[model samples]
Target: MKNKIEISDLQVHYRDTSALNKVSFDVHENEILGIIGPAQSGKTTLLKVINRTLEFVPEASMDGTVKLDGVDISTMGDIYGLRRRIGMVLPLPVGLPLSIYDNVAFAPRAAGLRSKSQLDELVERCLQQAALWDEVKDRLSTLGTKLSGGQQQRLTIARALSHQPEVLCLDEFSIAIDPVTTMRIEEVLKTLQKEMTILLVTNLVQQAKRLATRTAFFLNGDLIEIDSTDVIFSDTPAQQATYDYINGTFG
Candidate 1:
């Protein structure tokens, strides 16, 4: 498989504390890459770095290179264009103060899409992709924040999909949702991976096993191991720490 993203000697620091240290990895195109780790393990930080959002932090400093499609992201002139290519969904659903239809249409509109018919089609398609269309089809005008937690999460996913990103980065997306709803979104992700490369930062190990083509284990600013999901979840991984973490023996 060809690499969609490449990270080389990447390091992220917040003042005197390190978030990630000399991390190196490649994300294959059109594959779901699961990132599993405990709290403060820098899984979220890695996603931010990939999308160049880490630069938003006043105290954060980064070293090394992150390339998208072999082009270094740091040298990219269009920050907005770059972000649009990498959609992000955070742990909590941050619904905009807009209607469901408007929420999904926002990004496309900002990118200069104006035709009502085109916006309508894009909104419906994105919602369908998120597995939320059937649930909210009749309620497009309702405020997105008025939806249930799981529904709002799905709406956020729909909004992220509006731009048709090449890469989708989800940071603990299922954390606030119920199991059934999480399963529904997981199915959506399975379908989406065929179109876009996915970087999934998840605390749930089983979720990774179910969705990720390959999995990476992170611990205390270190990348412990990365391999096929089968190998990572099996009795033998390249690293004992990976096995321990996967088996619930340790984090």
Candidate 2:
């Protein structure tokens, strides 16, 4: 299997403190790799680095390399093009203040799609992919900001997918949602996995086990182990730290 993305000796430093330390991993095509750890354990930082947003923060200095689809994004000319290909959904749902229809169409329009019919088709297609079209189609003119928290989050995912990105990075996707809504989002992600690579950050072990093809453990900003979900969950390690964490001795 071809590795869709690879990170080597990855480190992120904020001035004097290191937020990520010597992280390395491969995200295979069409698979979900859960970056799991407690809060402030670098899981979100890892996602930011993978999605290339860490560069946006001026205080962050990254060391080592990250390659996506055999190309180093650092050497790319069009950062927007790269970003469009590898989309990200942050912890918070972000949408324009415009109508829900316009929110989904924003990316395609900015990329130069002008035909109203084409944009309309794109919006529906994406919202359907996000599992939100059925609920919002009748209210296209409504403001996206007016959506409920879970609805807004699904809309954000739709917006990311509208660009036909090859990879989707999500940070804390189900954190603020009710159980039913979280399940709905998970179902959408399950279906989309065939069309996109997924890198997720989740503190919920059950969610990680249910959604990810593989799981990577992050502790004190370090990657301890990465393997298939079953292996990670079923294998007994001699090191008590890993076993203890898995068995609920500690996070």
Question: Which stretches in model 1 have alpha-carbon errors above 4 Å?
Answer: none
Best-fitting candidate, scored by lDDT:
1
RMSD of 2: 1.5
**lDDT (10s digit) by residue, model 1, range 49-151:** 8888998999999999999999999999999999999999999999999999999999999999999999999999999888889999998999999999888
Error of 2 at 143 (Å): 1.3
The CA lDDT of each predicted structure is 0.93, 0.85
Report the C-alpha displacement of residue 105, candidate 2, in angstroms. 1.0
Q: Tell me each candidate's TM-score.
A: 0.98, 0.95
Query: What lDDT tens digits, residue by residue, belong to model 2 across residues 7-65?
Result: 88999898888888999889999999887776777888877876678888999999888
